[model samples]
Target: MAGTNLQTPILQVDHLSMKFGGLVAIGDLSFTAPRGEITALIGPNGAGKTTVFNCITGFYKPTEGMITMTRASGEKFLLERMPDFQITAKAKVARTFQNIRLFSGMTVLENLLVAQHNALMRASGFTVLGLLGLGGYKDASRASIEKAVYWLEKADLMDRADDPAGDLSYGAQRRLEIARAMCTGPELLCLDEPAAGLNPKESLALNELLLGIRRDSGTSILLIEHDMAVVMEISDHVVVLEYGRKISDGSPASVRSDPKVIAAYLGVDDEEVGDVLVEVGDTSVIEELDGVAPVAQGPAETSSMFEGPIADTVEEAGGETIVPASPAASKAAQVEAETAAKSPVEPKGPAQ
Candidate 1:
């Protein structure tokens, strides 16, 4: 992966916080996504990751914190102070939702052309010049169509250009939404769960498409996703959040190895997970168990998010911690005990 100059981040969230009367969706979280990199924000359900996205995109005003965005040309703007339209127009940031928000009744080409509405409207003097086909509206219209066609080809949807967006396959719709966003010519693209319902083939295609966008267009991507495969495979940097706060931020490998992160995924407190030395054999010797040996977490390993297993509190016999005879039994007993201890876990509050 290519690296960017570290002097300034393309988007910087500083001590950001959000409150909805009494619920704190985000609490004093901060992270910097460098320009030209795919920075993935991931966490368990209800981690307030999307709330952070909303704050950055000007959908919600932060109770406290500063969002500083630096344009490609070196102009810096306080994003929190800007309106949503300014964030899109001046800041050059684009976003796609988890739910496909395409114009279902419109043709695929029309949906993308609509993304360029602002530029066309300007060229048309807000319809007066466009209706008369006067001024530069004709030229602008041509350029807009050209841009839409360009993105359609890139997304492999040119053949569907005249097709209604709602009639396309689910995966095609996902690609179309992304292509529609790209027509706006954004510097920073924020995607929320682009791979949500994609099949393996569709997910792979998305990976290639995003990589092409970064390599060819130099657009920075900040994404919120639960798909670990997508997050770990495509992101240049990964930020992990827990309970509305950042628990780890680094390269995928570094964050994966961090014991705190291991604990987070394993549903154990960092303090309870001891470093373990594993020796697998017919009579394997496992030491440093402490009845809470931390499992070495790999990229995107936890499917259950907030729920995971803990080791059984076995006796340390002859200076060697004993694991249960049957691995399955151990997991069953451990999970049951852990659930009993942490039962009635409070639901993570609603996202704003």
Candidate 2:
């Protein structure tokens, strides 16, 4: 196999679009994973992060666009045109899913060994030489074991090498999945939500493992992650998505401070949006955002925005009205009161 190109990006997704019937899952998405760096794809829920992964990994054929994987010798493979297995075998791409997909019944070491199946089969000449334990089969099997052991140590799974994969803890299972992908000797590794469901400690450990993979093995990683801690700490580049379109793409610090990125994640209520927009230097949008103010149409509309009996209070207080400092303040107070009323209170008694 030829070595990968260090100068060019390992993966280039250009104008990629995936649509299921009338629903567009990803639209005209484009990004690159540079060689020997960790690039993160981040977004709010239903942002088509995983859909992008599926398109890259060949799980879903994109509706329109090109996915090109370039290697060190300057060989370019059109990933969109290849079968999923070909993408892995010929293109040297490996990926782990958002959910762990391991042979649970198999021992930890066996799972890693399975990743080398194709190589071993060729070395065995379709298992004929292996059945007789002759030729290069012995050497290939030994090398496979050594490779598995190497990843086991890297993943901190040496202690559980003989244990069943299903018995490992959730975090351990996550590591094992990555380790298995690494055993395939991928030039480009695509990881979907690798840090999902991890504790602080586990997240930190995962960060280290990913950094080590780039530093030592020279594998370029493209990851989809919601954990900002993981994304900000290790990613060399970050691409953000919203409603199937690219919203922000830059360094972790830049993306973190971007107004669009912040607003997307905030999911802020109408009253709080102006403040957020102001803070993010989006003053132009503040007036537009605040312009959608609720009008007091009727008693139901008034009651929906405000809690308690305002008229009764005013009547009982000798017709004296307490006025807010400003329209924004008044709106803020109304939203706060309405939110408090809508929040679910904990039950004091046991179940019936």
The TM-score leader among the candidates is 2
lDDT of 2 by residue, 1-352 (tens): 6765466888999999887653557777888888888999998787789999898888899999999999766789999999999999989999999889999999999999999999899999999999999889999999999999999999999999999999998999999999999999998999999999999999988998999999999899999998888988999999998657777888988988887677666356775664564455432222221223333322322211121122211111243434332222222333333444456898799868
Judging by lDDT against the true structure, name the best candidate: 2
Candidate 1 segments whose C-alpha is farther than 4 A from its true place: 1-7, 266-352
Model 1, 1-352: lDDT tens digits are 3333556789999999886653456778899998899999988787788899999999999999999988877888899999999999899999998888989999999999899999899999999999999999999999999999888888889999999999998989999999988988988999999999999999998898899999999899999988878887999999988657787899988876765556545344433433221111211111111122223432121322121222235433354544343222223334334445445677898898
Clashing pairs in 2: 4-72, 5-71, 5-72
TM-score of each: 0.75, 0.78
**Cα misplacement distance, residue 248 of candidate 2 (Å):** 0.7
Candidates' RMSD to native:
12.5, 12.0
TM-score of 2: 0.78
What is the model-wide C-alpha lDDT for candidate 2?
0.80
